[model samples]
Target: MNQGKTKKIVYKTVLHIVLIILSVTMLVPFLWMISSSLKTTQEMFASPPTWIPRYVAWENYTYMLQAAPWMRYFGNTFFISALTIAGQLITCSMAAYAFARLRFKGRNLIFLIYLGTMMIPFQVVMIPQFKIVKILGLVNTHWSLIVPGIFNAFGTFLLRQFFQTIPKELEEAAKIDGCGYPRIFWEIVIKNSKPAIITLVVFTFMNTWNDFQRPLIFLNDDSLWTLSMGLAKFQGTYVTQWNQMMAGALITMVPVLVLYIFAQKYFVQGIVMSGLKE
Candidate 1:
Protein backbone atom coordinates (compact mmCIF):
# COMPACT_ATOMS: atom_id res chain seq x y z
CA MET A 1 0.00 0.00 0.00
CA ASN A 2 2.87 2.37 0.84
CA GLN A 3 4.60 1.58 -2.45
CA GLY A 4 1.35 2.14 -4.41
CA LYS A 5 0.89 5.47 -2.65
CA THR A 6 4.45 6.50 -3.55
CA LYS A 7 3.88 5.70 -7.24
CA LYS A 8 0.63 7.69 -7.23
CA ILE A 9 2.45 10.65 -5.69
CA VAL A 10 5.11 10.48 -8.35
CA TYR A 11 2.53 10.30 -11.15
CA LYS A 12 0.60 13.24 -9.74
CA THR A 13 3.75 15.31 -9.32
CA VAL A 14 4.83 14.65 -12.89
CA LEU A 15 1.36 15.51 -14.16
CA HIS A 16 1.41 18.76 -12.23
CA ILE A 17 4.85 19.61 -13.61
CA VAL A 18 3.64 18.99 -17.18
CA LEU A 19 0.54 21.12 -16.57
CA ILE A 20 2.60 23.98 -15.12
CA ILE A 21 4.91 23.90 -18.13
CA LEU A 22 1.96 23.97 -20.52
CA SER A 23 0.32 26.79 -18.61
CA VAL A 24 3.49 28.87 -18.74
CA THR A 25 3.86 28.14 -22.45
CA MET A 26 0.34 29.46 -23.10
CA LEU A 27 0.81 32.44 -20.79
CA VAL A 28 4.06 33.61 -22.43
CA PRO A 29 2.28 35.43 -25.24
CA PHE A 30 -0.11 37.17 -22.85
CA LEU A 31 2.77 38.16 -20.59
CA TRP A 32 4.69 39.42 -23.60
CA MET A 33 1.65 41.45 -24.67
CA ILE A 34 1.37 42.99 -21.21
CA SER A 35 5.08 43.80 -21.20
CA SER A 36 4.92 45.25 -24.68
CA SER A 37 1.90 47.34 -23.73
CA LEU A 38 4.01 49.05 -21.10
CA LYS A 39 6.89 49.80 -23.47
CA THR A 40 7.40 52.72 -25.87
CA THR A 41 7.23 52.26 -29.65
CA GLN A 42 11.01 52.48 -29.79
CA GLU A 43 11.37 50.05 -26.91
CA MET A 44 8.90 47.69 -28.59
CA PHE A 45 11.11 47.21 -31.66
CA ALA A 46 14.40 47.36 -29.81
CA SER A 47 17.33 45.08 -30.60
CA PRO A 48 17.39 41.62 -28.91
CA PRO A 49 13.66 41.88 -28.08
CA THR A 50 13.39 42.61 -24.38
CA TRP A 51 10.79 40.54 -22.56
CA ILE A 52 10.82 43.01 -19.67
CA PRO A 53 10.61 46.67 -20.66
CA ARG A 54 13.17 48.87 -18.91
CA TYR A 55 10.72 51.76 -18.92
CA VAL A 56 7.01 51.12 -18.35
CA ALA A 57 4.69 53.56 -20.10
CA TRP A 58 1.55 53.84 -18.00
CA GLU A 59 0.21 56.53 -20.36
CA ASN A 60 -0.49 53.89 -23.03
CA TYR A 61 -3.74 52.96 -21.26
CA THR A 62 -4.81 56.59 -21.05
CA TYR A 63 -3.77 57.18 -24.65
CA MET A 64 -5.67 54.15 -25.96
CA LEU A 65 -8.75 55.22 -24.00
CA GLN A 66 -8.56 58.75 -25.44
CA ALA A 67 -7.99 57.48 -28.98
CA ALA A 68 -10.97 55.08 -29.13
CA PRO A 69 -14.44 54.72 -27.67
CA TRP A 70 -13.42 51.58 -25.77
CA MET A 71 -16.04 52.18 -23.12
CA ARG A 72 -18.74 52.17 -25.78
CA TYR A 73 -17.32 48.99 -27.24
CA PHE A 74 -17.30 47.49 -23.75
CA GLY A 75 -20.95 48.44 -23.31
CA ASN A 76 -21.90 46.87 -26.63
CA THR A 77 -19.95 43.72 -25.87
CA PHE A 78 -21.43 43.38 -22.38
CA PHE A 79 -25.00 43.92 -23.60
CA ILE A 80 -24.62 41.52 -26.50
CA SER A 81 -22.97 38.87 -24.34
CA ALA A 82 -25.62 39.15 -21.64
CA LEU A 83 -28.50 38.89 -24.11
CA THR A 84 -26.83 36.12 -26.04
CA ILE A 85 -26.46 34.10 -22.82
CA ALA A 86 -30.11 34.61 -21.92
CA GLY A 87 -31.34 33.69 -25.39
CA GLN A 88 -29.22 30.56 -25.62
CA LEU A 89 -30.20 29.44 -22.13
CA ILE A 90 -33.89 29.75 -22.98
CA THR A 91 -34.03 28.45 -26.56
CA CYS A 92 -31.35 25.80 -26.25
CA SER A 93 -32.74 24.49 -22.98
CA MET A 94 -36.25 24.30 -24.39
CA ALA A 95 -35.08 22.56 -27.55
CA ALA A 96 -32.88 20.24 -25.50
CA TYR A 97 -35.73 19.38 -23.12
CA ALA A 98 -37.93 18.50 -26.08
CA PHE A 99 -35.22 16.41 -27.72
CA ALA A 100 -34.23 14.62 -24.54
CA ARG A 101 -37.58 14.16 -22.78
CA LEU A 102 -40.67 14.83 -24.92
CA ARG A 103 -41.99 12.16 -27.23
CA PHE A 104 -43.11 13.14 -30.73
CA LYS A 105 -43.15 11.73 -34.26
CA GLY A 106 -39.69 11.57 -35.83
CA ARG A 107 -38.14 12.99 -32.65
CA ASN A 108 -34.84 11.14 -32.95
CA LEU A 109 -34.67 11.73 -36.70
CA ILE A 110 -35.44 15.42 -36.28
CA PHE A 111 -32.83 15.72 -33.55
CA LEU A 112 -30.25 13.97 -35.72
CA ILE A 113 -30.97 16.37 -38.56
CA TYR A 114 -30.81 19.31 -36.18
CA LEU A 115 -27.53 18.04 -34.77
CA GLY A 116 -26.15 17.66 -38.31
CA THR A 117 -26.25 21.41 -38.77
CA MET A 118 -23.21 21.64 -36.52
CA MET A 119 -21.22 19.81 -39.19
CA ILE A 120 -21.81 22.69 -41.63
CA PRO A 121 -19.08 25.30 -41.57
CA PHE A 122 -20.17 28.80 -40.61
CA GLN A 123 -18.51 30.27 -43.73
CA VAL A 124 -20.82 28.24 -45.99
CA VAL A 125 -23.97 29.65 -44.41
CA MET A 126 -22.67 33.15 -43.64
CA ILE A 127 -23.96 34.77 -46.81
CA PRO A 128 -27.40 33.11 -46.73
CA GLN A 129 -27.78 33.84 -43.04
CA PHE A 130 -26.84 37.46 -43.66
CA LYS A 131 -29.47 37.63 -46.40
CA ILE A 132 -32.10 36.19 -44.06
CA VAL A 133 -31.18 38.66 -41.35
CA LYS A 134 -31.23 41.41 -43.98
CA ILE A 135 -34.75 40.42 -45.04
CA LEU A 136 -35.75 40.62 -41.37
CA GLY A 137 -34.31 44.18 -41.20
CA LEU A 138 -31.87 43.12 -38.50
CA VAL A 139 -28.67 43.91 -40.37
CA ASN A 140 -26.42 46.55 -38.77
CA THR A 141 -28.44 45.97 -35.61
CA HIS A 142 -27.31 43.99 -32.52
CA TRP A 143 -30.17 41.61 -33.21
CA SER A 144 -28.17 40.13 -36.07
CA LEU A 145 -25.61 38.88 -33.58
CA ILE A 146 -27.95 38.05 -30.70
CA VAL A 147 -30.65 36.23 -32.66
CA PRO A 148 -28.28 34.08 -34.69
CA GLY A 149 -26.19 33.10 -31.68
CA ILE A 150 -29.21 32.18 -29.55
CA PHE A 151 -30.38 29.04 -31.32
CA ASN A 152 -27.08 27.23 -31.66
CA ALA A 153 -27.28 23.58 -32.76
CA PHE A 154 -24.26 22.74 -30.63
CA GLY A 155 -25.85 24.35 -27.57
CA THR A 156 -29.01 22.29 -28.15
CA PHE A 157 -26.95 19.15 -28.53
CA LEU A 158 -24.90 19.93 -25.44
CA LEU A 159 -27.83 20.62 -23.12
CA ARG A 160 -29.77 17.70 -24.58
CA GLN A 161 -27.09 15.27 -23.50
CA PHE A 162 -27.17 16.80 -20.03
CA PHE A 163 -30.96 16.72 -19.91
CA GLN A 164 -31.03 13.06 -20.96
CA THR A 165 -28.68 12.10 -18.14
CA ILE A 166 -31.50 12.97 -15.72
CA PRO A 167 -33.28 9.87 -14.37
CA LYS A 168 -36.72 9.10 -15.80
CA GLU A 169 -37.73 8.06 -12.29
CA LEU A 170 -37.71 11.72 -11.28
CA GLU A 171 -40.14 12.61 -14.06
CA GLU A 172 -42.40 9.67 -13.18
CA ALA A 173 -42.42 10.67 -9.52
CA ALA A 174 -43.28 14.25 -10.43
CA LYS A 175 -46.04 13.14 -12.79
CA ILE A 176 -47.69 11.07 -10.03
CA ASP A 177 -47.69 14.21 -7.84
CA GLY A 178 -49.79 16.12 -10.45
CA CYS A 179 -46.91 17.97 -12.17
CA GLY A 180 -47.03 19.06 -15.79
CA TYR A 181 -44.33 18.89 -18.45
CA PRO A 182 -43.36 22.53 -18.02
CA ARG A 183 -43.37 22.28 -14.26
CA ILE A 184 -41.19 19.14 -14.21
CA PHE A 185 -38.80 20.72 -16.70
CA TRP A 186 -38.46 23.88 -14.67
CA GLU A 187 -38.41 22.40 -11.19
CA ILE A 188 -36.66 19.08 -11.79
CA VAL A 189 -34.60 19.01 -14.98
CA ILE A 190 -33.42 22.61 -15.06
CA LYS A 191 -32.70 22.70 -11.35
CA ASN A 192 -30.59 19.54 -11.59
CA SER A 193 -28.78 20.69 -14.74
CA LYS A 194 -27.22 23.81 -13.26
CA PRO A 195 -23.70 22.66 -14.09
CA ALA A 196 -24.55 22.11 -17.76
CA ILE A 197 -26.47 25.38 -17.88
CA ILE A 198 -23.51 27.21 -16.38
CA THR A 199 -21.29 25.42 -18.85
CA LEU A 200 -23.45 26.71 -21.70
CA VAL A 201 -23.54 30.16 -20.16
CA VAL A 202 -19.76 30.37 -19.91
CA PHE A 203 -19.26 29.05 -23.43
CA THR A 204 -22.00 31.14 -25.07
CA PHE A 205 -20.97 34.21 -23.14
CA MET A 206 -17.30 33.82 -24.06
CA ASN A 207 -17.92 33.02 -27.72
CA THR A 208 -20.37 35.92 -28.08
CA TRP A 209 -18.01 38.19 -26.22
CA ASN A 210 -14.97 37.34 -28.36
CA ASP A 211 -16.81 36.94 -31.63
CA PHE A 212 -15.19 39.14 -34.29
CA GLN A 213 -16.49 37.89 -37.64
CA ARG A 214 -20.28 38.10 -37.08
CA PRO A 215 -20.06 41.57 -35.57
CA LEU A 216 -17.67 42.82 -38.26
CA ILE A 217 -19.94 41.62 -41.06
CA PHE A 218 -23.24 42.61 -39.40
CA LEU A 219 -22.25 46.03 -38.09
CA ASN A 220 -20.87 48.92 -40.13
CA ASP A 221 -21.34 51.73 -37.66
CA ASP A 222 -18.54 52.50 -35.21
CA SER A 223 -20.98 53.20 -32.38
CA LEU A 224 -22.33 49.64 -32.59
CA TRP A 225 -18.90 48.07 -33.00
CA THR A 226 -17.71 45.48 -30.46
CA LEU A 227 -14.33 45.34 -28.73
CA SER A 228 -13.00 43.06 -31.48
CA MET A 229 -13.80 45.69 -34.09
CA GLY A 230 -12.49 48.50 -31.92
CA LEU A 231 -9.22 46.61 -31.56
CA ALA A 232 -8.93 46.46 -35.33
CA LYS A 233 -9.02 50.24 -35.47
CA PHE A 234 -5.54 50.17 -33.90
CA GLN A 235 -4.26 48.80 -37.21
CA GLY A 236 -3.92 51.65 -39.69
CA THR A 237 -3.16 51.54 -43.42
CA TYR A 238 0.50 52.35 -42.78
CA VAL A 239 1.25 51.66 -39.11
CA THR A 240 -0.13 49.46 -36.32
CA GLN A 241 -0.20 50.94 -32.85
CA TRP A 242 1.33 47.89 -31.15
CA ASN A 243 1.63 49.37 -27.65
CA GLN A 244 -1.84 50.85 -27.50
CA MET A 245 -3.35 47.76 -29.11
CA MET A 246 -1.72 45.47 -26.58
CA ALA A 247 -3.01 47.63 -23.73
CA GLY A 248 -6.51 47.46 -25.18
CA ALA A 249 -6.12 43.73 -25.81
CA LEU A 250 -5.16 43.25 -22.19
CA ILE A 251 -8.22 45.20 -21.08
CA THR A 252 -10.45 43.22 -23.45
CA MET A 253 -9.16 39.94 -21.96
CA VAL A 254 -10.18 40.83 -18.39
CA PRO A 255 -13.92 40.05 -18.51
CA VAL A 256 -13.46 36.63 -20.10
CA LEU A 257 -10.84 35.82 -17.50
CA VAL A 258 -13.16 36.86 -14.70
CA LEU A 259 -15.96 34.79 -16.25
CA TYR A 260 -13.79 31.69 -16.40
CA ILE A 261 -12.63 32.27 -12.84
CA PHE A 262 -16.26 32.23 -11.71
CA ALA A 263 -17.53 29.34 -13.85
CA GLN A 264 -14.41 27.20 -14.06
CA LYS A 265 -15.69 24.60 -11.57
CA TYR A 266 -18.83 23.83 -13.60
CA PHE A 267 -16.94 24.27 -16.87
CA VAL A 268 -15.09 20.98 -16.55
CA GLN A 269 -18.09 19.16 -15.11
CA GLY A 270 -20.34 20.33 -17.92
CA ILE A 271 -17.89 19.24 -20.58
CA VAL A 272 -17.54 15.77 -19.08
CA MET A 273 -21.21 15.13 -18.36
CA SER A 274 -22.39 16.40 -21.74
CA GLY A 275 -20.23 13.80 -23.48
CA LEU A 276 -21.58 10.82 -21.52
CA LYS A 277 -23.93 8.82 -23.78
CA GLU A 278 -26.97 7.22 -22.25
Candidate 2:
Protein backbone atom coordinates (compact mmCIF):
# COMPACT_ATOMS: atom_id res chain seq x y z
CA MET A 1 0.00 0.00 0.00
CA ASN A 2 2.89 2.31 0.87
CA GLN A 3 6.48 2.67 -0.48
CA GLY A 4 7.96 1.66 2.92
CA LYS A 5 5.80 -1.49 3.11
CA THR A 6 6.70 -2.31 -0.51
CA LYS A 7 10.43 -2.03 0.36
CA LYS A 8 9.94 -4.33 3.39
CA ILE A 9 8.19 -6.93 1.24
CA VAL A 10 10.95 -6.78 -1.35
CA TYR A 11 13.60 -7.19 1.35
CA LYS A 12 11.86 -10.23 2.86
CA THR A 13 11.41 -11.81 -0.58
CA VAL A 14 15.14 -11.37 -1.28
CA LEU A 15 15.99 -12.82 2.16
CA HIS A 16 13.79 -15.85 1.55
CA ILE A 17 15.47 -16.51 -1.78
CA VAL A 18 18.92 -16.32 -0.15
CA LEU A 19 17.87 -18.71 2.64
CA ILE A 20 16.48 -21.22 0.13
CA ILE A 21 19.73 -21.19 -1.80
CA LEU A 22 21.74 -21.70 1.41
CA SER A 23 19.44 -24.51 2.56
CA VAL A 24 19.87 -26.39 -0.73
CA THR A 25 23.63 -25.89 -0.58
CA MET A 26 23.73 -27.35 2.93
CA LEU A 27 21.54 -30.31 1.91
CA VAL A 28 23.67 -31.32 -1.14
CA PRO A 29 26.23 -33.27 0.86
CA PHE A 30 23.56 -35.05 2.85
CA LEU A 31 21.72 -35.92 -0.36
CA TRP A 32 24.93 -37.15 -1.94
CA MET A 33 25.65 -39.33 1.07
CA ILE A 34 22.20 -40.87 0.77
CA SER A 35 22.76 -41.37 -2.94
CA SER A 36 26.17 -42.96 -2.53
CA SER A 37 24.94 -45.34 0.14
CA LEU A 38 22.31 -46.71 -2.23
CA LYS A 39 24.61 -47.20 -5.22
CA THR A 40 27.36 -49.80 -5.63
CA THR A 41 31.03 -48.83 -5.05
CA GLN A 42 31.67 -48.63 -8.79
CA GLU A 43 28.64 -46.43 -9.35
CA MET A 44 29.84 -44.13 -6.60
CA PHE A 45 33.25 -43.61 -8.26
CA ALA A 46 31.88 -43.46 -11.81
CA SER A 47 33.05 -40.77 -14.16
CA PRO A 48 31.01 -37.51 -13.97
CA PRO A 49 29.05 -39.20 -11.13
CA THR A 50 25.29 -39.79 -10.97
CA TRP A 51 22.66 -38.33 -8.67
CA ILE A 52 20.32 -41.31 -8.83
CA PRO A 53 21.32 -44.93 -8.49
CA ARG A 54 20.55 -47.37 -11.34
CA TYR A 55 19.77 -49.90 -8.66
CA VAL A 56 19.02 -48.95 -5.08
CA ALA A 57 21.40 -51.38 -3.37
CA TRP A 58 19.47 -51.75 -0.15
CA GLU A 59 21.95 -54.45 0.77
CA ASN A 60 24.43 -51.82 1.91
CA TYR A 61 22.45 -51.28 5.12
CA THR A 62 22.08 -55.03 5.58
CA TYR A 63 25.77 -55.46 4.87
CA MET A 64 26.66 -52.84 7.50
CA LEU A 65 24.63 -54.61 10.15
CA GLN A 66 26.20 -57.98 9.36
CA ALA A 67 29.71 -56.58 8.98
CA ALA A 68 29.72 -55.00 12.46
CA PRO A 69 27.96 -55.31 15.80
CA TRP A 70 25.96 -52.14 15.16
CA MET A 71 23.07 -53.16 17.41
CA ARG A 72 25.46 -53.61 20.33
CA TYR A 73 27.03 -50.25 19.56
CA PHE A 74 23.58 -48.61 19.56
CA GLY A 75 22.65 -50.21 22.88
CA ASN A 76 25.92 -49.21 24.54
CA THR A 77 25.61 -45.65 23.28
CA PHE A 78 22.01 -45.36 24.48
CA PHE A 79 22.93 -46.60 27.95
CA ILE A 80 25.81 -44.17 28.24
CA SER A 81 23.68 -41.26 26.98
CA ALA A 82 20.78 -42.06 29.33
CA LEU A 83 22.97 -42.37 32.38
CA THR A 84 24.89 -39.21 31.53
CA ILE A 85 21.62 -37.29 31.08
CA ALA A 86 20.31 -38.45 34.48
CA GLY A 87 23.57 -37.68 36.24
CA GLN A 88 23.93 -34.26 34.64
CA LEU A 89 20.31 -33.36 35.44
CA ILE A 90 20.86 -34.14 39.11
CA THR A 91 24.37 -32.70 39.56
CA CYS A 92 24.07 -29.64 37.31
CA SER A 93 20.63 -28.54 38.54
CA MET A 94 21.63 -28.81 42.20
CA ALA A 95 24.87 -26.91 41.62
CA ALA A 96 23.04 -24.28 39.57
CA TYR A 97 20.37 -23.73 42.25
CA ALA A 98 22.99 -23.38 44.92
CA PHE A 99 24.91 -20.81 42.92
CA ALA A 100 21.84 -18.89 41.81
CA ARG A 101 19.58 -18.96 44.91
CA LEU A 102 21.41 -20.21 48.00
CA ARG A 103 23.58 -17.93 50.10
CA PHE A 104 26.92 -19.23 51.32
CA LYS A 105 30.41 -18.05 52.08
CA GLY A 106 32.70 -17.70 49.04
CA ARG A 107 29.79 -18.71 46.79
CA ASN A 108 30.40 -16.21 44.01
CA LEU A 109 34.14 -16.84 43.95
CA ILE A 110 33.58 -20.59 43.96
CA PHE A 111 31.04 -20.34 41.14
CA LEU A 112 33.37 -18.15 39.09
CA ILE A 113 36.20 -20.63 39.58
CA TYR A 114 33.99 -23.50 38.45
CA LEU A 115 32.61 -21.58 35.49
CA GLY A 116 36.16 -20.78 34.42
CA THR A 117 36.71 -24.46 33.88
CA MET A 118 34.51 -24.17 30.78
CA MET A 119 37.42 -22.41 29.07
CA ILE A 120 39.67 -25.44 29.63
CA PRO A 121 39.46 -27.84 26.73
CA PHE A 122 39.02 -31.55 27.33
CA GLN A 123 42.46 -32.14 25.77
CA VAL A 124 44.11 -30.49 28.78
CA VAL A 125 42.13 -32.54 31.29
CA MET A 126 42.06 -35.87 29.45
CA ILE A 127 45.33 -37.19 30.91
CA PRO A 128 44.40 -36.50 34.53
CA GLN A 129 40.89 -37.82 34.01
CA PHE A 130 42.19 -40.94 32.31
CA LYS A 131 44.54 -41.60 35.24
CA ILE A 132 41.69 -41.03 37.67
CA VAL A 133 39.46 -43.44 35.80
CA LYS A 134 42.28 -45.97 35.64
CA ILE A 135 42.97 -45.67 39.37
CA LEU A 136 39.31 -46.11 40.19
CA GLY A 137 39.24 -49.33 38.10
CA LEU A 138 36.74 -47.76 35.72
CA VAL A 139 39.02 -47.62 32.67
CA ASN A 140 37.20 -50.24 30.65
CA THR A 141 33.80 -49.77 32.26
CA HIS A 142 30.91 -47.53 31.19
CA TRP A 143 31.49 -45.47 34.33
CA SER A 144 34.62 -44.14 32.67
CA LEU A 145 32.34 -42.41 30.19
CA ILE A 146 29.32 -41.68 32.37
CA VAL A 147 31.02 -40.42 35.53
CA PRO A 148 33.50 -38.00 33.96
CA GLY A 149 30.81 -36.49 31.72
CA ILE A 150 28.24 -35.94 34.50
CA PHE A 151 29.84 -32.91 36.12
CA ASN A 152 29.92 -30.37 33.32
CA ALA A 153 30.53 -26.70 34.20
CA PHE A 154 28.75 -25.54 31.04
CA GLY A 155 25.54 -27.33 31.97
CA THR A 156 25.69 -25.86 35.45
CA PHE A 157 26.29 -22.38 34.04
CA LEU A 158 23.45 -22.65 31.53
CA LEU A 159 20.94 -23.75 34.15
CA ARG A 160 22.26 -21.19 36.60
CA GLN A 161 21.58 -18.33 34.19
CA PHE A 162 18.07 -19.67 33.65
CA PHE A 163 17.55 -20.14 37.38
CA GLN A 164 18.53 -16.55 38.13
CA THR A 165 15.71 -15.19 35.97
CA ILE A 166 13.08 -16.88 38.14
CA PRO A 167 11.41 -14.42 40.52
CA LYS A 168 12.81 -14.44 44.06
CA GLU A 169 9.27 -13.79 45.35
CA LEU A 170 8.15 -17.26 44.41
CA GLU A 171 11.00 -18.76 46.39
CA GLU A 172 10.31 -16.42 49.32
CA ALA A 173 6.65 -17.41 49.28
CA ALA A 174 7.60 -21.06 49.35
CA LYS A 175 10.00 -20.41 52.22
CA ILE A 176 7.32 -18.48 54.12
CA ASP A 177 5.09 -21.51 53.73
CA GLY A 178 7.77 -23.44 55.71
CA CYS A 179 9.15 -25.21 52.64
CA GLY A 180 12.78 -26.16 52.86
CA TYR A 181 15.49 -25.75 50.23
CA PRO A 182 15.17 -29.20 48.67
CA ARG A 183 11.39 -29.03 48.63
CA ILE A 184 11.39 -25.58 47.05
CA PHE A 185 14.03 -26.64 44.57
CA TRP A 186 12.08 -29.67 43.43
CA GLU A 187 8.59 -28.20 43.58
CA ILE A 188 9.20 -24.65 42.43
CA VAL A 189 12.53 -24.27 40.65
CA ILE A 190 12.48 -27.47 38.65
CA LYS A 191 8.79 -27.20 37.78
CA ASN A 192 9.37 -23.78 36.26
CA SER A 193 12.62 -24.72 34.47
CA LYS A 194 11.51 -27.28 31.91
CA PRO A 195 12.71 -25.35 28.84
CA ALA A 196 16.21 -24.96 30.25
CA ILE A 197 16.32 -28.56 31.49
CA ILE A 198 15.21 -29.86 28.10
CA THR A 199 17.81 -27.66 26.43
CA LEU A 200 20.48 -29.10 28.68
CA VAL A 201 19.17 -32.61 28.12
CA VAL A 202 19.35 -32.20 24.33
CA PHE A 203 22.89 -30.81 24.45
CA THR A 204 24.27 -33.33 26.97
CA PHE A 205 22.59 -36.25 25.26
CA MET A 206 23.86 -35.22 21.82
CA ASN A 207 27.41 -34.71 23.08
CA THR A 208 27.58 -38.00 25.01
CA TRP A 209 25.89 -39.92 22.23
CA ASN A 210 28.14 -38.63 19.43
CA ASP A 211 31.33 -38.80 21.43
CA PHE A 212 34.09 -40.82 19.71
CA GLN A 213 37.29 -39.82 21.48
CA ARG A 214 36.24 -40.89 24.97
CA PRO A 215 34.89 -44.23 23.82
CA LEU A 216 37.88 -44.81 21.57
CA ILE A 217 40.38 -44.01 24.31
CA PHE A 218 38.67 -45.40 27.44
CA LEU A 219 37.19 -48.51 25.87
CA ASN A 220 39.45 -51.29 24.74
CA ASP A 221 36.58 -53.73 24.19
CA ASP A 222 34.59 -53.69 20.95
CA SER A 223 31.31 -54.49 22.70
CA LEU A 224 31.54 -51.26 24.69
CA TRP A 225 32.23 -49.13 21.62
CA THR A 226 29.64 -46.49 20.58
CA LEU A 227 28.24 -46.05 17.08
CA SER A 228 30.61 -43.17 16.47
CA MET A 229 33.47 -45.51 17.28
CA GLY A 230 31.96 -48.34 15.26
CA LEU A 231 31.91 -46.13 12.17
CA ALA A 232 35.67 -46.44 12.10
CA LYS A 233 35.33 -50.08 11.04
CA PHE A 234 34.29 -48.88 7.58
CA GLN A 235 37.60 -47.07 7.32
CA GLY A 236 41.01 -48.75 7.22
CA THR A 237 44.56 -47.54 7.18
CA TYR A 238 45.24 -48.88 3.68
CA VAL A 239 41.79 -48.67 2.10
CA THR A 240 38.40 -47.09 2.70
CA GLN A 241 35.02 -48.33 1.55
CA TRP A 242 33.40 -45.07 0.50
CA ASN A 243 29.93 -46.50 -0.11
CA GLN A 244 29.74 -48.46 3.11
CA MET A 245 31.22 -45.54 4.99
CA MET A 246 28.40 -43.34 3.71
CA ALA A 247 25.89 -46.00 4.71
CA GLY A 248 27.35 -46.28 8.21
CA ALA A 249 27.47 -42.51 8.56
CA LEU A 250 23.78 -42.15 7.63
CA ILE A 251 22.90 -44.84 10.14
CA THR A 252 24.96 -43.13 12.82
CA MET A 253 23.28 -39.80 12.11
CA VAL A 254 19.75 -41.13 12.62
CA PRO A 255 19.51 -40.76 16.41
CA VAL A 256 21.05 -37.28 16.48
CA LEU A 257 18.74 -36.20 13.67
CA VAL A 258 15.69 -37.62 15.43
CA LEU A 259 16.64 -35.97 18.70
CA TYR A 260 17.04 -32.48 17.25
CA ILE A 261 13.89 -32.75 15.18
CA PHE A 262 11.71 -33.39 18.22
CA ALA A 263 13.53 -31.11 20.65
CA GLN A 264 14.17 -28.23 18.23
CA LYS A 265 11.37 -26.06 19.59
CA TYR A 266 12.11 -26.50 23.31
CA PHE A 267 15.82 -26.11 22.59
CA VAL A 268 15.20 -22.71 21.02
CA GLN A 269 12.46 -21.57 23.39
CA GLY A 270 14.40 -22.50 26.54
CA ILE A 271 17.24 -20.03 26.09
CA VAL A 272 15.16 -16.95 25.29
CA MET A 273 13.24 -16.82 28.61
CA SER A 274 10.34 -15.03 26.96
CA GLY A 275 8.01 -16.36 29.66
CA LEU A 276 9.71 -14.38 32.40
CA LYS A 277 8.16 -10.98 33.19
CA GLU A 278 9.53 -7.79 34.74
> Which candidate has the highest TM-score of all?
2
Candidate 2 residue-wise lDDT, 153-271, digit = tens: 87888888899999999999999999999999999999999989998898888889889888888998888889988887447531667787788899999998898788988656545
lDDT of candidate 1 over 1-278, digit per residue (tens): 99999999999999999999999999999999999999999998899999888998989999988888899999999999999999999999999999999999999999989878878998999999999999999999899999988888878888898898999999999999999999999999999998788888888877888999999899988899999888875565326778888998998889988877888886676567556633
Candidate 2 TM-score, C-alpha based: 0.92
Clashing pairs in 2: none
Full-model lDDT, candidate 2: 0.88
**Local lDDT at 37 for model 1:** 96
Q: After superposition, how far is residue 103 of candidate 2 from its true place, in Å?
A: 0.8
Error of 1 at 265 (Å): 2.6
